[model samples]
Target: MSPPYDLVCFDLDGTLVQGTVFIWQTLHDFFGTDGDRRRKAKDDFHAGRISYRQWFEHDLELLGEAGATRDLMLAAIAGVRPTPGGHQTLAVLREAGLGLAIISGSIDLVLHRHYGQVSFEEVLINHLSFDHRGALVGGTPTDFDVDRKGAGLLEIARRQQVDPKRVAFVGDNYNDVSAARAAGLAIAFNPRSEELVETADVVVEGDDLRGILPHLLDE
Candidate 1:
């Protein structure tokens, strides 16, 4: 039988990659950046006191002040690895002719660091800028993060010429609720939040990414 969905979008942290719930938090921890400041910025963004871009820029500024460089940031997340069966899952889905994309709040560095060889039709993530010496300079934040994740999913569907009902989304945290609700098939793999589990159509409890395959493909 044909696949149930035309496109599959994934969240980066905790979903595709293991060992980090949120890459931003990991970076802040590694750099010893101010936790209080980070929380304040996050609150401001949620409170409409700041835009997502402003919060992103503020985080980058904090990292830059702490002397973060491309190399160092990479080093900070060295322990992070792709989920078990992650590559296989992507490969199988690609082989099945399903469109694959990533809609994440995480940065590109983490994705490239682990799944650089894998290809996605669309990748919506933050971009970090660096100088010739590899020092962190500035960055572009994704608009489709947090509550906007669902919008990202819709955008991908529009671009792919697929109806939103023909798309699937896989995610783990509370932030994933919007996207999950927007998807035709929502799989909560190793979910970290009650909201996500409640929102998901199917829940896979494990570290292996292959667990989601049965829901996407005909057995």
Candidate 2:
């Protein structure tokens, strides 16, 4: 059978890595971001008192304060593991001749290194800034803002010369909902929240990433 979609986009964090967000989780492990300040920033962002840009900026600042240097981030990320069958799933998708893309709000260098073995034709993610000495400076502007991920996905399709209706986007969070819905097809992979379940066209639940493969092809 032909591939179900012209292009398929995957979210990098929980969807692929099967762990917490790379930057924050790394911060918690290497450069602690605990306490009231972190909570307030999160709450404010969810409440719209602060924008996603501000939330990320605040988080990066806190991380830098906690001594998050490039080397430290690389060390913290070294231990991260991909979701079960993540590599195999990508292989299968490629074998089936689907264009694959990564659309994420996570740090670019981190994801690039983590998933370096895998191949993605299009990658839309945020970049981290580092000083000459390799200390964390900040983050570069990114198109993967919360709720705007759909726009990024569409942009990928545009660049790939694929129709929007021929795209599939998979994610595991409420932040991924809008993007998934905007795509031609939406798959919620091991959804951790109710909002994600309701937002997706298909839901695949399992410790293994291969579970999504069956849903990607027409019967």
Candidate 3:
């Protein structure tokens, strides 16, 4: 049965943006001797053992410990342009009448700054707060569950006034599998993860996100 979805949710890092692992590697640089700490914090966030805000603070403190300023963090992410044709594809998809959203595990530092380029209908991401002097502090919506990527989609659908059956989801990693399972169509585009490719209902090969347009809309 085809689910109805006038809406579509997208994953950020590996889906629209390219070279996502660089941020992870950068965090590792900040982690120093306790590199495993990064992974552990991520696991805790995903498993609901800790809130998203707490997990981000704990991990970013480790990242900032190396004196990595928030400016530098922003630059690292800003340097990341979307994958080939990503911007245009998003433009085309939006023009095609599909509601677009950005759901990512990336921090607000990145999305808050650059999300305008993509014009996502809604953006749900982690964040780190700061003071007037620009010192790192904490985030609101204090507790977020990273493992429950699917819940965000449901929320997005409701917020957009789009029917659950009308939504289509796209991603490039294992974390996205749950969102895919929950969406009307689960699409893996130029996917690097083998498991993700296997479970996807549509495998879009190559750089263009426009490829998935046919499935989500009629023109």
Candidate 4:
């Protein structure tokens, strides 16, 4: 039988990459950016005082002020690795002829660092830019973050000429709830919030990424 889904989109930080909850928060902690300032920017964004782009730029500015560089940022996440069995899972899914994508608010650097060898049909995440000297210059923030993650999923389905009901999304946190609800098959793997669990079609608790395979693949 054909696979139940044509495409699968994953959230990067906690879902695909282990040992990190949010890449932005991880960078802030690594660079010693002000917590108060970070929180304020975040609050302002959520309160509609600032656009998502503005909040993204503000965070990048904070990191730039702290002398963040591409090399340093890479080093900060050097110890972070893909979730256990994540590589194998992706390989299996690809072999099954399912399209793969990433819809996340995490930085592109993290994705490139860990899953660089892997190929994805689409990647919707923040892209960090650097100057010739490797200093943090600026970044391009994604529209598909937080509450908009569901929209990202739809965009992918549209681009692939597939019905939204043929898409599956796997994620692990509250931010992932929107996409989970949007997908035909939603798997909450190692979920961090009750909201996500409540929204998911399948909830698998474990560090192993392969735990989701049975739910996604036909027996």
Candidate 5:
């Protein structure tokens, strides 16, 4: 069977990486675990109060105090091995000629590890600024991506020169659900929250993202 869509967009954490967001895990290592905040975010996510962007942006801001640099974030992400089937599943999608995109709320340094590994043709993540000498100043990113996730998907489709109707997006958060639903088809993978699961055309409960494979094809 042919693939159901021409493009595939994926969220990094929970969707592909699974469990903790890379940055947060590092922060927890540095500052010690704060289960209260985690519970609060999860509760809010389930209660339809805050978005994945808000939860992530808040967590990042909390971690900003740790004085983590672009280098440190990269190191942390390297520690976060992708879910069991992430890379293989990605290879399958790329082989199918699907325009791949990584539309994530995470920092650029963390997502950059995906280069030459995951099938994403282009990635859109929060960028960090540094001096000419390459030291992280720990300031806010000039162009935050949360507000632009959906537009990023559209931009990818435009750049790939594929019809918007031919694109599919998958994720596990409410923020991603909006953009995913806007795509030709949306697959929610092992969603921690119900809002996003409800938005998806297909919801896979298994941690193995490869479960998403069948949904991508038109038998």
Candidate 6:
């Protein structure tokens, strides 16, 4: 049978991987930045005191000050790992002829370093600026950063020339709720909250990513 969906998009941190708030942790772990400033900025952003761009810029500046370097980030990512079934699921999707992509708030460089082996046709992620010497200089936040995941999904649909109704999104956290709503099918993988489960059309809980395939393929 033909693929049920033309595109399947996934969130990076905590969805395709094993953790959340990865960017913050990477900055702290590698650069020795306490991240207290970022915590305050995040609170302010959440409280509507700052725009997402502002919150992101403030943290980028902090990271730059802490001397975040490419070498340091690479060192930090060395200990990270993918979701248990992440690679397997990607292969299954590709074999079935479904286009795959990743839309995430996490840094792109980090994702590439860790998941470079995975085959994804499109990747929409935040970019970090680096100096000629490869030291961190700044960052660029995408729609994923401002709780605009739905918008990201729509943009993907537009680019792929596929109806939004022909897309499925799999995600884990409350942050993914809007994106799920935007897609034709919403699969909550290893759901993080009651709200996420309630919002999803299908919920798959467990460490194995392959568990999600039955619901998806059976469609």
The sequence of per-residue lDDT tens digits that candidate 2 reaches over residues 15-116 is: 878656545656666766665788899899889999888888888888888888888887877766788898888888888889889988777866767688
Return the TM-score for each candidate structure.
Answer: 0.98, 0.90, 0.82, 0.98, 0.74, 0.91
- Please give the TM-score that candidate 5 achieves against the real structure: 0.74
Q: What is the C-alpha RMSD of each candidate to the true structure, in Å?
A: 0.8, 2.0, 3.4, 0.8, 4.6, 1.9
Instruction: Kindly list the per-residue Cα lDDT of model 6 for residues 49-135, writing each as its tens digit.
Output: 998788778877777787778887767666666889888898888888888988787788767876888768778788888889989
Q: After superposition, which runs of candidate 5 have C-alpha atoms over 4 Å from their true positions?
A: 21-29, 32-65, 74-79, 114-119, 129-134, 138-147
Model 4 C-alpha lDDT per residue in residues 38-115, reported as the tens digit of each score:
999999999999999999999999999999999999988876899999999999999999999999999999999999
Candidates 3 and 4, the one with greater TM-score:
4
Off by over 4 Å in 1: none
Sequence-dependent TM-score of model 6: 0.91
Candidate ordering by lDDT (highest first): 1, 4, 2, 6, 5, 3
Clashing pairs in 1: none
Per-prediction backbone clash count? 0, 0, 8, 0, 0, 0
**Candidate 5, after superposition: displacement of residue 175 in Å?**
1.8
Q: On a 0 to 1 TM-score scale, where does candidate 3 land against the true structure? A: 0.82
Better of 2 and 3 by TM-score: 2
Off by over 4 Å in 4: none
Go through the candidates in order and give each one's C-alpha lDDT: 0.94, 0.82, 0.69, 0.94, 0.69, 0.81
Comparing 5 with 6 on lDDT, the higher-scoring candidate is: 6
Worst 10 residues of 4 by lDDT: 73-82
Give the C-alpha miss distance for residue 215 in model 4, angstroms: 0.6
Give the winner by lDDT: 1
